[model samples]
Target: MSSSSSHPDLILTNARITSMSSSPLPSNSDAIAVTHGRVSSIGPTSAIATLAGPSTKRIDARGRSVVPGLVDAHNHGVKACLARLYACSFTFSASPQDIEAALEGFFERNSGVECVMGGRYGSEFFKTYAGQLLPTPREWLDARSRGRAVYLREESGHNGWANSRALELVGITRESVDPKGGRIGRTDAGELTGVLIEDADVQARLRWPDWTAAQYEDAVREYVKVANGFGIVGSTDADANEGILKALSEVDREGGLSLHVVAAQTTPYGHREEPLDYGLHERWRELYTSDHVDASFVKIYLDGVARDDSRTAFLLEQYLPDPRFPESHRSHAHVPAETLARDYVELDRRGFTVKTHCCGDGSVRATLDAIQAAREANPARSEIELLRHEVAHCMLVSASDIPRFRRLNAVAELSPYLWSGESCVSHRRACLGSERVERWYPVKELLDAGTELAAGSDWPAAVASVNPWPGLASLVTRTDTSDPSSAPIGLDQAVSIEDALRIFTVQGARAIKRGKDTGSIEVGKSADFVVLDRDVMEVDPRMVGATKVDVTVFEGRIVYEREGAN
Candidate 1:
């Protein structure tokens, strides 16, 4: 316990600081002291004032509410940023003409570019407009694309639409076989229909030109700038890669990266029915540490999405059979059960924390079962806290798997941003049927079961914006932020505002193995916090997402300040 004057670097006074800690101090404090990028003291305004030295800067919070900076427990910053900067995307509500107009405008501007790519058209495009433009042929795309390859990733990121030239670039022909666990849409006469799913999409990406490392760095810088404006201090890059790592390291070294990041190397999955080589750890072993980067975690996608329009997600029960393929309607996992469990045991034995994308009940159970197997096979390492594995997008967890999360100490990385959105609900009902739709996201159940839970935006992939505020609000309101009049997705699963904030803060930090360093604004913890435009607790819960961030402080530095907030 050093006196504030001995090390004070900055002080914030006349503030309502919600420390998010269980300490005995007042919940709303008047002041806080920061030294060496960490909190040193917190108490009455006068108490903090007495310890401030002449060199210490002081910020007058003007009674604004301050809490630990928010974290996106799971995100793909590279993908999200690139999607906005380099791709041709339209809003979910945009009509086919709007999409065509955007594409025409894009082609007119970038005539020299070899390929046109970007997407996320909603289910309406597939369900209602399929006859008009969806099963669109190469001729339609070629007319607008000027012979350049055209690939549009669906909102789910698991499926794509490609023109004939783009398909030809990937060498897909009528004679081509659908990659195992993936599909290539074809007509009843067996002609290619230009739609690719699962592994098929991966093939397209592999053939597509890569973004230069410098471009990735620029995109990340832009993303961080946007995130800073939203009061985000850190995030977990769910789909980390060599290019992403290089970009983050460059920005961090240049003093441009304001957000702390835990980068997870994407794990290997099935390719054409055979598991890809399992030496990711060996190949990436040297990248285990870097400034603003943690490469110890690995990411895995257990299955794709399972909605009415996209039945690619692995499931415990069969989906209502498609008329085209009635007997094989249920989605399948990316990896076989035995192989997944074996890989889990191997990764656990080697001391790597893994996070898997689990959109359906079958995938969630499979992920948990793998962890349980790892625990059983590696008894010597069972108690290691650093081994806390994670499961992302627990979209449709089974009632039985709810307890397994607690028993296995698994972290549930939820994207409540989609929890109450209209498009999300429609997908559930159409793909999962009416009865199963009621079991959508089970956040409250997980929390009530004593399972650790954290929130994320899954940005660029979801149909909503990347800001976590709307997601936080959805956790409490369980209704659409865009249209509050819409029905709640699952009001029974809603959490309190305070608990929602905690999920975005403290719990998020714990999920990334940084609990002791930040999360809560306590003595000896990193001084990462946000000053809101209003007292979130006092505002209408439905309006929480609209609340602005007045100031964002990371590592004791004022990184972002709203122009008129002061």
Candidate 2:
């Protein structure tokens, strides 16, 4: 072996490395060298040792496994951090009594604050009435709100339960009309129930107290620490408003960011009449573009969740009969087909990647249609083909549309956190029927169709933690890693461990538009990888979720090291 002209900055040896590269290395290769934040050399330990100078740092992996740093294709980075740090938090499976107890404790701790925000009771909580009933959601929240304006987001983040003070503050009176593409729950007499769905929830949340810049900065810092600890080197912030973007930009500017964040600026959801602020996206791109922050992405919600109580997801078939509405009702798209196609074409032309939230088969089809329109509209532009627009949350895609994903060069951004047979899945089955529920996720079929699959945690929305192991495990086993006794929802949809890893790594980076720079451990790419506590490939499929990150390295720098780890 010969040494290079310049010495390396860091080296790792005596470990199993999954490079995820197209080219295969020697069978005996087990070392990597990094210089100037990029992989400089990769070969056997003895060969790479010759490239190291006196100042180069050497790490002995001691027979651990190393893989490319994970990427989360869809996440609300700032919102998740804020909720973890300040909100009255509860699990998606928490009971009404549990939620009330959480709220009471939060209120007592922040006695002087006028507004309180927390959430995430399961969607089933709204329909089951498992606890004492009040006249309406407003009364139910009022009893536990301590006279403070309270707004608790539902598990799916598409609905909310607000106290009277919150409703009054947000100006939802008896005469208030439901916003287009959303609903305001009401009693038979047309009185407000303090249940806001779809755009109505957006309205209340926008009107709620805004956090200060300092608060946002703190949240951004905390988010980086949490994400890096979980082996995430990069993520796409699913919804980034001005506040979130500014915080991310400032952090990256100050050289405090350890994660690459592709900010998907928020666009109007469920409002077909509203125009997308293309100018706003361009302006943010110019102002917030930094070393680690890319602001050229945008997020759109084509429809809401598919759960029965909400009945907001745009479905191809009619939902099961419910007392709340007409028997023939199948939810509709937020934007008309023509409008969606037009917007998508323009966004695609402008070099912006769009991620549309599609929870139902109908919405999935509509999104694919729009992408097809964009491709046809700009047949000559190579950039159009490169834009890889995404259908976020492909919870239920019609069997026919599966091939369109690969044909349109689109990405299926799957949230593994929701794939398990959890309570929320049961709620979806109640409205969606057994046949539709049985086909949930369809991971293997998408892969077989040559569709690029990207994995995301959707943290703090449906899932409580950012840990990817459990979700990774669920991808292969189709069962909740947390509960061994739980049944698998769609066992046939399970993918292999190798496919699951690729989805979380290279595919995720591709979804965020950073595939060329990161996502793999090949030479000349960024030195971003994680040392695992165990070899996930050798572990029992059911125990994959129990895997942990012992050390996370980003751009050749060790960012997170577990305490007492070898």
Global CA lDDT computed for model 1: 0.81
* Cα shift from native, residue 362, model 2 (Å): 1.1
lDDT of each: 0.81, 0.87
**lDDT tens readout by residue for model 1, 1-566:** 45445848889999988888867566546899999889989988888888888889888898888889989888877777877788787776666687789888787777777877878776556566666664454455566676778888777677788889999989999999988867898888897888887788887787888888877998889889888888898899888777887788778888888887888887554432444345766467455466677777788888888667667778899888677555757777888788788878888777778899988889899899999999888877535454888988888888988999888888988978886457767777876786776657788899899989988888777645678898899888887776868777767888899999989999998887778887889999999998998888889998897979988999999999999889
State TM-scores per candidate: 0.93, 0.95
The candidate that achieves the highest TM-score relative to the unseen native structure: 2
lDDT (C-alpha) at residue 24 in model 1: 58
lDDT of 2 at 13: 93
Least well predicted 10-residue stretch by lDDT in candidate 2:
126-135
Candidate 1 error regions (>4 Å) = 1-7, 26-28, 53-55, 108-111, 134-137, 269-278, 382-384
